[model samples]
Target: MHMKFIGLLLAATLLLRCQPSSSVDPITTGPEPEPYRIVRDSIKTGTYLGIAIDEQAASVYPKIQALQATKGVSALNVVSNVFADLIALKERLPLYQYILLDQKSGTDSGVQITVEGKTVKSIYLNSGQQLTQWPEKQAVDSSVRVGDAISTLYDKLVAIRNIDRYTNKFEYISLMTKNLSADYDGGMSQSPQWYFGFSTGPNQMDQIQVHFRGGKVSKLYIDHYSKY
Candidate 1:
């Protein structure tokens, strides 16, 4: 009886040992990584990249008119800064890019922004000046919509301007559609094709068309009054 009992105990001990000992080994994996451009606060986030792209092919008409009246060097369109002085951009010039400044000529419409020395930003204008072209809300198409129309307009505008000297850019035939038309109000600049004139006053329309197709905006137009 004692021998039988010992054998049974040994069997039970072996069975217990054979059972999978899983108290679940603790996982040592680390947490997942963060995204490229995530911003916690909705209001504090930036669209700097979007703004920069938009500025690439933007129209200087609205700002130029404002500057034309003031005859000032800088405005919503034209910006001049020192080669290294980013602090001078007092107010964040939203949707503007650096235009390479020309070392020699004080003004070269050929170049958007330029300075004798190198600029911290990619774009530059002549004489260390910079210009950021905002969308001509007035210039947007009223009929067709969808896709990236504003950027399209901006692309076409810059392509043309870049192809020719600054003088030619003012005259370069715009590929953009004149799908929507506003009667020439006449505060127009003497510059070529820039015939339409508008008040240098604040843009009253909540949103202006940036790009157009089939008589409508190509990209989503932000209705500043309403969240898009």
Candidate 2:
């Protein structure tokens, strides 16, 4: 009986030794990383396209003028017509992946821009409001189709609005793609634009329009309705 008891004790001791140590540090994991972008707590009182125009225009617009001159275009015309495009395409301009607009009143707005090297590829504008007016509904062309861009935009909206906290406050409406006019004549074959709509309240919906050029978002429009 003593010999049997000794063998059992040895086996139990070996089993304990083979078991994982309770003191061993656990391997911890975190959420996926987000893209880099400039975020400001408040939008400057006097700013244009999220930049302080008074401080930046003199130094920045001049370079844009030079580029316009190369194309035999007048600075005034370019400034009036394609200033945003010029700023986005300019290599010298600072590149940003996202910009968060947090107002002093505690309201938050955000803009996400996708960039490839020095070129601005796409832009996403999110205003925390539900949309009521939809002027572009008639312009939608069902022939154009959107791929994963809609899904990406949906995920982005959820992240921006903290929709998980509201629990069924918003409902997915539709995702559509359309060919939009890029110029006055509508001659240029611009990339198809994606429109994602969501119903935020009873009989109220918000729409986000994303325009892509060369597989990159060239423009983003957020038509939101005030919750109040």
Candidate 3:
């Protein structure tokens, strides 16, 4: 009887050891996050009419000259010497402005390229009084450009997750378009300039304006201090 009991106990111990174990997986680390996704995915820079931001003045001048020669586009260079502030005047920081006229009455209705200290500062492209004209609505970047429908730009802007706080808000204002050519009698009409203001902190706001001509984007205005 004693031997049988010992045999039964040994058999039960062996059966318990043979049973499958309930597994508990070890802790694992997740994949690393990409730090540059926001910047990489965001619309940060713009290219206007073969000119880009931060391009050397020497190189850009030649291209502008070529455009003038080939396209019959008038180019004018002016230096801004007047400043309301005394310090600014004393500094003698002159802005080298290269204007591309659209055969309109005034330089205001033209593409203005501003450079400070041999660096291209800002680019403002707008259609002249004709509802369509020179500067030929070019790309601001791969994703956005002049001549694109305003709705398309809006859609692209809304889809950007970065800078949502600022990009989401927009203001629309009318820009005056006038043709001085005897037919129109210098008559002025209204076109829309959509403004989108972005701010990262107090006292500083970066702005972008999309000016429309004939219901399409004819102007792309980028601020020098803009991040987008």
Candidate 4:
């Protein structure tokens, strides 16, 4: 009986030894990197496309006239000569009900400006479109204009760490490619590190997205928001 008991005890001890340990090593990993920033507040005041928020239509007309002459391949037939004419006449005559800058023609890509009391109210620049032959200046910073290269934009802006925070490294590397073929059509630069802000409404924020098309900045414009 004693010998049998000893054998059973040894077998039980072996079984226990074969079981996994109840205590486990904690998983070890590095801290997650910070996410890419985005402009959170509305931007109310700034100059865009050479026009200020409250600038009179008459004061900005001459500049518009000049810009009309420089219409690029994207803007042709989109904004008719009547646009300049209406602005010219609307200064003295009430020929139109309201002045709205919209791109009904073309690829439905362009800047849309809303005017109230003959003053520019809101502006939304779509990176999907390029309207003028000459690059338009950013309202906040004229030094940073549309149609520039992504490399150029990085050089002009302040030091911004973790540019790929919003996107993975592989995707960011693809965007930084030079003059990507037209067959490769889509690109975006939404890292708040790259955007400029504007005050659009109370508690609302706006941003100028430095959008890229074919590896060049196609447009830079304030996204006027109404959110409070």
Candidate 5:
């Protein structure tokens, strides 16, 4: 009976050893959280133009106090020395543009002005998109060339999407001229525009559209499946 009991105990131990283990490998879970998703909440809040008046721009174009004299506008958006002459012919200019919305009257009005070295070169009142208010057409120079503009746009995207670390997650699809015309203004015009396209994946379902005009970003659009 003692031998039989010992044999039974040995058989039980073997059975236990043969049973499959429940422990799982720690590496089986999917890759670490995507870094871009960290800023997902901010991205969903509103449209991000990624426009900021930098130190150089601010130094060249100081804030205008007269804008507050207007009925509703209490402040102005001052952007200085944002663009440079490709030929290095002239100093960079500052841009004064502000938007004012009156909730009581449901009225909206704004002003856009371009200042060249302390002199107002152009002014547009109540203009939308500010396309019509772009400074007098100048030849596209190497200083603020298309390539430079593209780089700036890319940097802005990296900041806005918070994907600077995961830049590999995006693929630059193409940079094509949307409105390539030398006669844009009846003569050689500087307002040439291009559309830059980028996709988050090879599927090309999600895309980022960057519209560049006059060597500066004019508009930004994000096309994602979630939006639809």
Candidate 6:
């Protein structure tokens, strides 16, 4: 009887230790957790836009870094930023069509988040008075992944940047379009090769060219940036 009781005690102790910290314990069993799910149908769209005030604007990057630094968002302060109030950021998975805000209008700038996957397809800054437009509707095809789509888009955007008013040797610069064109006013610069912003400016020399691979862009060789 003593041996049997000792064996039972050890088994019970092991089982108790294995008991999950949370009652819901979706990770161990039960329905999927709020913030974690396997998105089916292949394509889902989610956009998070935030506008920051003066000091807050610069804090945006730091906030993101801090939140990530914690390894996990166990604490709230590590999660909240002037631009984003990620209070309930957890307990919820990436859903389609969502907007998060700290305070709409401010002195500094706002942020836009459009990610098909881990890859950022679009990012924008909101200047005061300027309206941030979230497309009411967007088309998402079954691309292998967001990275592939961005690679495709980057290639196309680069090609578009190649054609310049200056001497053309066919060079291109790869860029983060959403960030660079956040203001949308756009600009152009030249030295080794020409670079153009949003609105296609008049070419000083060769006709600007944009290469496309089907609906998605493939490869680009801008004259200035593209060593290609």
- Candidate 6 lDDT score at position 75: 13
Query: TM-score: which candidate is best?
Result: 3
For lDDT, the strongest prediction is 3
Candidate 1 overall lDDT versus native: 0.24
TM-scores vs. true structure, each candidate? 0.16, 0.18, 0.19, 0.17, 0.17, 0.18
Tens-digit per-residue lDDT, 1-228, candidate 3? 222222222233222321110110111133432121111121225655454444433343444445444433232211111122222221122221221212223223333232323333343543212222222352333223324433343233233213333221211111111111112211111223322223323222333333444443454564423122
lDDT of all the models against the reference?
A: 0.24, 0.26, 0.28, 0.27, 0.23, 0.22
Q: Write the per-residue lDDT of candidate 6 for residues 170-189, one digit (tens) a residue.
A: 12111111122122211111
Q: After superposition, how far is residue 146 of candidate 4 from its true place, in Å?
A: 37
Model 1, 55-167: lDDT tens digits are 21223344333433443212121111223222332222222222222223233333332111122122222233332431122233321112223324333334433533332
Query: Lowest summed-lDDT stretch of 10 residues in model 1?
Result: 19-28
Tens digits of per-residue lDDT, candidate 5, 1-228, equal 222222222233222321111110011123332212111111222234332222121121121122123212122211111121122211111111111111222211222232322233333322223333222252233111212232232232234224343232222111111111111211111323211122234322222333334443445444442211
* Model 6 segments more than 4 A misplaced: 1-85, 97-104, 128-228
User: TM-score of model 3 relative to the true fold?
Assistant: 0.19
TM-score of decoy 2: 0.18
Model 2 / residue 48 / CA error / Å: 18
lDDT of 4 by residue, 1-228 (tens): 222222222233222321111111111133432222233333335665564544443343343334433421011010111222222332222111111222233122233232223333333333334232212432323222333333333322221112333112111111111111112111122211122223333443343433333333344454443322
Which whole-number lDDT from 0 to 100 does residue 191 have in model 4?
Answer: 19
Residue 132 in candidate 5 has what lDDT?
A: 32
lDDT of 4: 0.27
lDDT by residue for model 2 over 1-228, one digit each (tens)? Answer: 222222222233222322111111111133432222222232224442222322322232333234333432111111001111222322212222212222222222223233333333343323323222111132222111122133233333334334343222222111111111111112112323423233334333333333444443445454442222
Report residue 3 deviation for candidate 1 (angstroms): 99
Return the lDDT, model 4, position 63: 38
